[model samples]
Target: MLDLTAPSFMRAPHEQLVRALDRSCFAETRIILFGKVKLVLGHPEIQDMLKDGGRFAVDARNAGHASPFGMKFLPASLRVLSDNLLALDDPRHRELRHMVDGPFRRIQIEQLAPSIRETADQLVDDMIRDGENDIVAGLCRELPLQVIFDLLGFSDETRGKLHDVMKGVAGGGSAFDVVRAIFRLKPAQAALRREFENVRSHPRPGLVSELANAGGDGGQMSDDELLAMVFVLFVAGHETTSHLLSTATYTLLMQPGAAYQFRRLGREARLVAIDELLRYCSPVQMTKPRHARRDMEFHGQSLKEGERVMGLLAAGNLDSRVFRNPTQLDLARRPNRHLGWGGGPHMCLGLHLARTEVLEALSVLFDRFQELALDTAPDNLRWTKRTGLRGLKALPLRLQ
Candidate 1:
């Protein structure tokens, strides 16, 4: 019944700009159209709609857009991955949050500081050793995946399957892609399931093992649960970070003075630059479509129950009211309230970890790679087809 011949949902630069302009206007328009989906863009009244949980919900089920594989697979696969925290609301979200929050503490991540830097250094070294290459494949993609793999205690033996699963989940939006994604994940899941079962009886010192053996009120995750969380974390966590790093690096490479300014600032200052890049790139340009659970008043419009809303995170970050000269990319934008990570209870659980990864990775690049430049013409670059995640698929570069 689905039209396979229909062109996949791809947004052109102009279309992206148009949607952006609509949001920048700062008017409360409930039914602004976006390709096929109607969105609620830039409603100040929605401020309460976001923080007030009981009214607006993150249920993507009714939104019915076919892009997010996680939303569609919620009944099957994502329920497990989301088990630890992201899926729950209210007391449950708080209860589960308290237990796992300890592991992601600044001190705990700080302890992994050496490991994080080592991963970035090794990846950069490898890239330098191998002259011209797709930076995404050689550099951007490997860093976070390695950190997460090491953290989860997955073996080098399973790296192939791990990569395959990530690819499948990330591109599992269209009908053509869905079949391929499902095929890709089936074998990967079987392998992970076997490993998880093996580890349950004999625990290891990794995050997966900890989750498997964890007890107390937080409730230990089931095998499916473990695999799903690991799956999402490995894919979503690294993929977005990869985008931020690649796009930020590319932006600086394109702009002469920006990279120089960024480098001179040192680690703490570069972190601020990275934060601006996150807002500027808005890699996860859009978030899950939120639907109203009840009649909600937002930015002057009255929305009846069941109306769908897509929060334009990039637009929200660029609103002139919140950010001065909203279009300009000033790395030192103080009090930057960008929602690079979404807000509310369902805010990205791995945000701190992600911040650490991006900051560390960018720090290394600025330090090691001098006179970094693109190997090809700007027109040759190809943007990825993901509606939610904005990034370059391949970045051919030369390091001096």
Candidate 2:
């Protein structure tokens, strides 16, 4: 069994794990580390499982039956955090998703391009002034956090507080750390509840206002649900994209001539390059555990009711049958159907915004800095000590 929480796996994950899993005789194997999670590695099998909503559910709270870590003992605050759209099933998911779907659509997100470009340009300017700094800290971290703060209409004070709160939440890997984060998150949640109510009373031009006004068959979400939704958006919206920017940039820099090739690409081509980067990086390494709705046969393996299954998205992205030369980074790779953003009804809600941030941030960085290189040795660079999410601890670089 692979201990994904170990420091070694956190550093370099995708290659060896995928290789071993792909070569394994079973399509799915039990990993004792993440509560004995039944890891689904094969591309086709993962796709089928993601699409089969009738047989598989995404409620993490209800996944206690499959969790070896004893999630039933988790605090109510922690349990409420799992009540967002990512954990919802069917009608409720569809309802809440429908309410907020229009705002995050491709066309809607494209409207924010000007502001995003401006923010990216400003971040590059700051980096240029510093001459030498960690890209992860200076650019990668700030860009997404700033964008989301602007989008949500959060005040500067609130933004700083929220950043600290999220850092506490993301920094933890163990059960004890999670409990600590939950305790620290109480004030943050209360603040968000206040913001939601404020937005409800006085409409503003932001996602919070949109969500505050959202209504459907299920009626308005409770204060707890709203708080959970905001928490998800804040965490998922920034954390994954920030890591994507850092790792994608690192990957391109590491590959000889890859950065130049990416720079030379046209607008549409650059967009394609972003897609390829997403495929290659597979930043969010795995999906949240999905519970089987009933006893079922999947890929010749029998799964009991409520058994947990996690789609190894990074593995599927590197599957040889689907992507040729799976180990190589092809900037112009076409017909790329990588499950980087997951699939089915539970796909990432902020994908358009994320793509926009990556494209603009990378473009600005390479364009502004003439000769950019790593300040530290590649081996010295560290990965965050967190499971499910893969990202750099710091990306120190010199821009001349």
Candidate 3:
């Protein structure tokens, strides 16, 4: 069994697992679940797995068994957060996606760009005034949290309340991890349930009203589904992006030439540079477990029906077959249609907004402090020890 908690593994699983990846396109990993499941490591193979919704299922019901995302350990009371898009397929997935995805479309999020930049600037200003060096708390966490809360029309008090709970979220999907997350979420779920009702009675700005009034779009999403959507939106909205912003900053600072190169780019070019960083750092290390729809031969491996498979997004990002010098950080690399943000039908729902926030956050940080540098030694920095995610615990910086 792979010891997920092993210090060496937690510190750098990719490096340790690289051999398995190099040896074969498909391997077995018990790190994520109780039973060993297929781990897709190659770039092309992972892409095929993610895109072939017919062959692979995010909702395990479509396969054969019922492996809902933590459904067994997940409490009924908290079904509100677990029964949403991540656990659905086909018409239902598309329907639920269409319901709330309106506000997140690039054109729509573009309208929020000005506000996003303002929030990024305000966060930077606050950090400077407080003489803060940790960019993770100063900006990475706050930028996305503020943006998502703003979209949800949440009050400052509510934002503060949920922020505390979300910040402490434990990542592995073990039974223990699931049980622990449930208790922490109950309070926040109740609070969100209230907000959903509030929006229904009185219209408000942002997605809260948009979703609370989703019935206007000729569909009725149940309360549990709605709650899951809202909560997932809130959590997913910030978590990965927070990591992306922090890790991107750390990567750039460590590579001064890359930092200098990024700074020279205009808005358009900076967006391109963001993709390269996304490819290099790969904030999301793995994807939700994908179940095989039926017994099939893939990349020479015989997969049984209902067998769980995981896409190693981080590993695929390092595939030499696709990316030249895959291990090296190249901020200017183009033709970079990497799985950093994900691919296919189930790609990140907030990709547009996330890209915009990370881009603006990076731009503001670099522009404000032309002499920015790491305040601490690289080895001393902390990283979040979570399965399927990559991020910094804190990114201390020096602004001169």
State the C-alpha lDDT per candidate.
Answer: 0.65, 0.78, 0.78
lDDT of 2 by residue, 261-296 (tens): 987888789889888888888788788778887788
lDDT, candidate 3, equals: 0.78
Clashes of 2: 0
Candidates in order: C-alpha RMSD to true structure: 5.0, 2.7, 2.5
- Model 2: lDDT to the true structure: 0.78
- Estimate the TM-score of every prediction: 0.84, 0.92, 0.92
* Candidate 1: regions farther than 4 A off: 1-35, 43-47, 60-87, 171-179
Per-residue lDDT for 277 in model 3?
A: 85
The candidate with the higher TM-score, 1 or 2, is 2
Cα lDDT tens digits for candidate 1, 273-373: 87888877777766565666677676666666655656656666666667777667788888788878777776776776777888887777777778667
Instruction: Tell me the tens digit of each residue's lDDT in model 3 across 1-400.
Output: 3344454654455565567667887766565344676678888999999889989988877888754752345456565565677778777888888887788899999899999999999988888899897889888888887888888788566677688776656332334554576678777777777777787899778777777776754387776787778667766767779888988898888775878888898988898888888887778877788888899998899989888888888888888889888777777788896898777777889999999999999988888789889999988877775656677878889876
Where in model 3 is the C-alpha error above 4 Å?
Answer: 1-18, 32-35, 170-179, 216-218
